[model samples]
Target: MDQVTKIANRLADVGGVVAVCLGGSRARGTHTPDSDFDLGLYYRPPLDTSALRVLAAELTGGAVEVTEPGGWGAWVDGGGWLTVDGARIDWIYRDLDRVYRIWQQCKAGLFEVGTQAGHPLGVYSHSYAGEVAMGRILADPTNELAALQEQIQASYPQPLRDSLVAHARWEVPFTLSLARKGVTRGDAFYIAGCLFRVAGLLAHALHAQAGCWVLNEKGAVQAAGQLPTAPANFSARAHALFGALGATPDELATAINDADQLAADVLDNLSPG
Candidate 1:
């Protein structure tokens, strides 16, 4: 464990590397025995991943999963994955300029949600801000990470929260409306999709209210189920919403209404600390 931290500290010496930190479950101290080590490298524009790739190769002494800087497309364009001494380590690249801009926009009452490949549920721009602010700094020789944490950590701006809340409030009903329409058309697939989308939106809203930054939609349900405001037996409810074998139209409508009301109540009473 110390060696991994030591290696991460060394990565900060690379050019354009502003900070290197530990993130994800490990940083949050929520890691299980099998959880992967998430090493985040904060860099400004003109990032060079060669140093990372070379280091990974040196550590593994074999082929490693790495991409040339900017090769992986948006959201994550650099970094690599390595297994050092049987410990799984994932390197994630963060553009400090982009994260800073997103955090600034969040403070200015601006936020946007969109979906990307491999992230079917969705993503929010403000998520990056939270990660940067909440991450555990491992190497910050120039004090860049310290400065960023000062501006971003645990800072829940009202605009960002309100934006997400409003978005969820609208989306829940919008999808429910479509689901109702699907019943009329006997389109089970449409209803299923609507349910999935509404679940994700509700989960997103809950995370926002909890002052949690969500990077993807994959774990939204389980995470939301743990929130204080979330309904009891959320996993069961999710199953009922998504798992209905030849369910009648009326049953589907009931589920939709239940979700709608649950989402509304949660949004209305939200108070992020």
Candidate 2:
């Protein structure tokens, strides 16, 4: 860990970079051997990407796919995919300006689900609060993460919980309705997509009940499965939801009915199931 911290600190030493931190399952100590190294470099606005670009070009040996700030998406900002010493390393760019705004929004009882591509979970950006609050700090010359974590965890604000629960309550049923319609239309693909949305919303509700914050859909189920409201035999439910049976549309009608029941259960509960 010390060695990794030194590497992260060196990366933070890059011009315009304020700090570098570890993220994802590795940071949480839940990583598999195949997990990619998730590193995020936080920077203030008007950041110069030139140094980062050159470093990336050198690190990945001219196979760099770095993007400018906000090029990937608003909340995620930007970063790069690089291979160093034959290991998969994900270099993420975090705009401190945006992070601060999102953090403030969280404090002020504001949050929204990201409908942008790759975020099918519709997670609230303020959930980045988790990344900042719970994530391990690697480098903080100016103590940026310490202050950020303090502010983020200042309280387990009820409003944030209320907001997530409310969103999940509505979204789950709504998406399930779409899934039912897809079943009637014999649209297996549409039904499958809706199931993903259903699970995502259920995960949101579960997290909210536990007063937990979520950043992405990655490992959402594993995070939520331990909660009380997690469905019975969650692995089987998830497998069925994702079509482990490869159910045809006619077969999906039963799945859709089961899905509706799942949504109803989640909605009726004071806490997630």
Candidate 3:
């Protein structure tokens, strides 16, 4: 068996582990030769972290620490990092019940972005559903994960799409207004932060309009640029705006104006999905 398959089997054998799946760029078939494996481990409550830690150590031939549930955060849950056979593997834990609940929320057009360390733009609650929709099952003895994945892949919820687009559309201008204030004071740092938020929000709106699930902020703008609903030169303009940001009041003001124009273009181009 391949290394990933072997790893997934081992993970599935761990007590409380309901399913194991491949995630990230690898699962999406967009991975480069160097992309590390992102493995999702869906488990019930009272997970056997001790077993997981032992298994990780065995796989790596060294001591490894597995975080307890909620160790990473509420949304991210917990897991461990390991290098098996010289290949990096990330174990991301998901509470099965929580995943179901979150998926239901997405179907109902209700989602929230929560603070998470690794996710600079915050973790979207629908990301759990996205993960399942995008993941490739490696081991699912009970067929629960497969069934859930099928349900998620069947269709992109219209309510979820509308909710995401509406929220992002509202935030883009609100965030830009904050950046405008910073431009007058030549607060490049603050202005830059707000601009990044604007870009991210615009990406979110575009992805929603395209009925795509945005897993995170990484490459989100570029991904949105690929969508038919995206504004012309959306990613290029966003990149240029960021590249042109300057510390001077006049330069910052110009960047703000460009960003506002980009936002208007995106809003104008958006159509009902």
Candidate of highest lDDT:
3
TM-score of 3: 0.97
Stretches of candidate 1 off by over 4 Å are 245-251, 271-273
Error (Å) of candidate 1 at residue 120 is 0.8
TM-score of each: 0.89, 0.87, 0.97
Clashing pairs in 1: none
Please write out the lDDT profile of model 1 over residues 1-273, one tens digit for every residue. Answer: 798778877788777788888888788787898898888888886666666667788898987777755665576556788888888988888888888888889887688766566666656777788777667888888897789788776577877777777788777787788788877566777777888888888777787777677766656788888988777776567656766624677776777776667666666666632
Local error of candidate 3 at residue 159 (angstroms): 0.7
TM-score (C-alpha, index-matched) for candidate 2: 0.87
Whole-model Cα lDDT per candidate?
A: 0.76, 0.74, 0.89
Q: Put down candidate 2 lDDT per residue, 148-262, tens digits, no spaces.
A: 8787777666777777777777777788777777765678888888887787777777777777777788878777777786766654566566655255676888877777776
Q: Which lDDT value does model 1 have at 205?
A: 78
lDDT of 3: 0.89
Local accuracy of candidate 3 as per-residue lDDT tens digits, 1-273? 288988998899889999999999999999988798999999997899999999998899999879999899888888999988878899999999899999899899999999999898889898899999999899999999999999999998889888877887788889988888887678999999898888888898888787788899999999989999887899999998888788999999999899999999888887643
Worst 10 residues of 2 by lDDT: 264-273
